[model samples]
Target chain A: MRTITKNGVRIDDTFAEAFPMRGTALILTGPNKRWARQAAVTMTGFATSVIGCGCEASIDGEVEARDTPDGRPGVRVLIFAMSSNDLQTQLVNRVGQCVLTSPGSACFSDLVAADALKVGDLLRYFGDGWQISKKFGNRHFWRVPVMDGEFLCEATTGFTKGAVGGGNLLICGADYEKTLRAAEAAVEAMNEVRDAIMPFPGGIVRSGSKVGSKYKALHASTNDAFCPSLRGMTKTALDDDIGCVLEIVIDGLTEAAVADATRAGLAAIIKLGPRNGARRVSAGNYGGKLGPFHFHLKDLLA
Target chain B: MTLVLTLKVTPPQRLDLSVLLPHLLADKSSKDVAAIDLATTREKITVGDLFRIRAGSAEEIRFEGGSERFDGVGQGLQQGRIFVAGDAGINAGRQMTGGDLVISGNVGPYAGSAMTGGRLEILGNAGDFLGAPREGELNGMSGGLLVLRGAAGRRAGDRLRRGTILIEGDAGDWLGSRLIAGTLIVLGRVGVSPGYLMRRGTIVLAKPPALASTFVDCGQFASSFPAVFGRFLLPESRGAARLFRAPLRKFAGDMAVLGKGEIFVPA
Candidate 1:
């Protein structure tokens, strides 16, 4: 195959594989956007992965007053868990501790569906004996009387299966600076894409981990094959001219999310390749054996 | 003219008015209010049958019927006006907080029991303990007005805290018993032991009782009747606002307990 390379970097032929996981999204509103963001950030903090954090959660985006049910500024937070039970537990605990405790903040379900069971029924007991429950339409809400006024929280959240580790791509360049620039371009392009998120910090991961570790105590270890400093010491997969590599991991709620993110990310990185010390693009995969999704980079870019 | 509900059938059994309070009927207009679905003897019945409901723009309800056995007629009514064309049943205007209820005819037992803030008026006689506390309630008629046009049954205005009750006709025994801090007026003759065991309320009786054992003779005094009744009974009266302009005599006692509440009678 005739390969496309910008500034002497190779574009790999493979694609990233992703698995399906269940996720839920919550919307938190406050007297203003600042307090809403504060509550949302606290609720989603340390919720990067299900392995360590019991769930993967983050502030998906900011919502305006018109987008909310109560006509207040809100922030949307997406939470992912291994199962329905885990999602419910983490959601209840985080909302009760973080959002409800924040001043003038009210939490409500962003995703409205009939099948979802709510969690606010249990947390409403915090009102002690004075709590009031209201049902509007099909959704139930709890009004916990507080000192300032009332803290209104939705009784339930909605959940659906979403694709995790979707549309991932790797950036390789002549040096670390070029590689980071390419990653940043990819991230910027992927921003605002619907139902998709780059879970790593800045949408790029410098320390990519392999499946298992050589040490008995560790389950996973760093991919030394891609490390520039260890090029001569380990079985290096990078060419001698290749200086740095960065990986972008994506997750989406569906197949379309993965495909759209992949397309945008590739286009952005390709556009920025020559100007930013240039780079080639590739994707991560386990030989099509790990996940159900297989995103072919050539098909995506085309 | 929100919603109106009219009874479709004259209930064979006693009708329950607990569900018909004004606060519960807020969202319904006068027309919709006349269409409330009620259950009688395990069968469904509508409100448009028994009484003719006239749609009014005012946030008040008028019932034109002479049937008795209406219970809890204005229970827990926080606001709005209710007028009964004829006599009422047990517990009429019970536990009312803020509203006006008027019964044109006599009322059954326990009218205006435990009323917190409102005004209730009965043009005819009233049963036992009118404007008194319920059997288990600690507070009684804390803030409201009750006026009876005719005689009252035994123990009228018992245990009242901070409201006013006026009786135009005769009163039964043990009137204003255990009254803490309210006003009770009897424009006609009071039966024996009018102010028995009263703590700190004003009870005015028209004629001095012959027995007069429990109540000490507080001495004769010249006082204007309309001023006395107007101060305590009529101004706040919901449907009987025109009946408070009469002369009265004031007597203070149930000296057997604390000697505070007075009994006022017509001069």
Candidate 2:
């Protein structure tokens, strides 16, 4: 494979390692955009990774009022987990606590066809016999009474198979400021890609990890191969002039989505060129031992 | 495509055509459809005797001529859609399970009685015991959606166990009387004794109705419950949707019974 270079930026001939994950999409609506967005943000908060929260979630996009079930301002959110059971647990807990508690907010499933999990069925207990169940079209919804009024939620949410999680792009630059700027631009561009979400804070992950740690009990540790501090002690993947590094982690409903987001992010960073300190773009993989989906950098941007 | 049944002559007495649902005739040919039995006042009669039948595979079945003497229009319907062109008699949709039933004109008593599932839309008025179960049965309209565009007679949604009934016009006395569990939304004026002996269910009244002595006012407050409930009504009518979006006065009552039923009036 031939490497592509734009100005001083090098596109590595590597691939991102992704594993199969279970996930579901939810639509949260409110009387207004502010309340809807607040509910969505709260539901996706503290959900950066399955390592800490047992799920990864983020606001995917905004929905038009006419398109929603209630003609209210709404947002689309996606949550992914390693297992379907874990995904369901996270979905019920987060929605029950965040969306059901939000004033004038309602939660709905975004999937049209798939195996469904009973999200609202489990949460309706909070209504304490006051709950009302409604069947509209082909879907069932629950109306749980609350202080703000009632929280309407779909009874079930659908999940699909072969969803890719943990695809990444490592941005290395000449200095901290330039590298960070390019990474920020890349994150912004990736956010526009459909069906994919960057789960880390601001869509950038600084503490990139490897499969194992020096401590026996740890499953993952810092990526010493790319760490600037460990460059002298370890066989570093970066060059001598590389001063700053940032990683963008992507999780998507499909491998194609992850690849598209990666290609978009790389193009956005490449557009910044050497002047912005974008030196090279690489990816993280565990020597083909990680997972099934592999998004090659060269083939993606080709 | 639609299966059209147009009456050729007026009937002297009531004709039980409840077997004329979409599910029964969807796959049948015109010749086969016309052979279906209809019990009239005089004797058992074939559908071809008094009406013309044009058949197709479409899920929609339309009755073209006036059917003032026709009864049990969609009884035991399991699937498909039904459209009645004119007035129909009693027991229009008894024990309906699934599908959509639309009546362009008025229907007599026991409309949507014991309906288990599906949607029934009455463009005109309905008679007594709308969505009510039969005398021997314990539940009425266990599941389904019943929308009445015009006024309803007494005892609307009586003993309803499940399902939703939306009345665009006024409801007569005993609205939702003895409701077991279900939702009855009256967009227009409601008559006396609304929610009487209700055990558990929801009654949304656009125009406040006179409550029984057993009820207790829960106080008027700003709420979003109506907005949520209103969304479900959007597909039925825009007026109904708007009726539920505003603040409402809620009353928990039918205290004479189990007392879990609630009535919400637009504030």
- Which candidate should be chosen as best, given DockQ against the real structure? 2
Q: Highest TM-score: give the candidate number.
A: 2
Q: How far out, in Å, is residue A3 in model 1?
A: 4.1
Give one digit per residue, the lDDT tens place, for model 1 in B70-189. 777887878888877777788889889888888898889889988877788898899998888887887667777787888899999888887667777888987877887666767677
lDDT of 2 by residue, B60-178 (tens): 88888757688998888889888889998999888989988889999999999999888899999999999998779888888889999999999999998887899999999999999
Total clashing pairs for each candidate: 41, 1
In model 2, how large is the Cα lDDT of residue A201? Answer: 91
Per-model root-mean-square deviation over C-alphas: 16.7, 2.3
Give me the displacement of residue A234 in model 2, in angstroms: 1.7
Weakest 10 consecutive residues of candidate 2 chain A by summed lDDT = A132-141
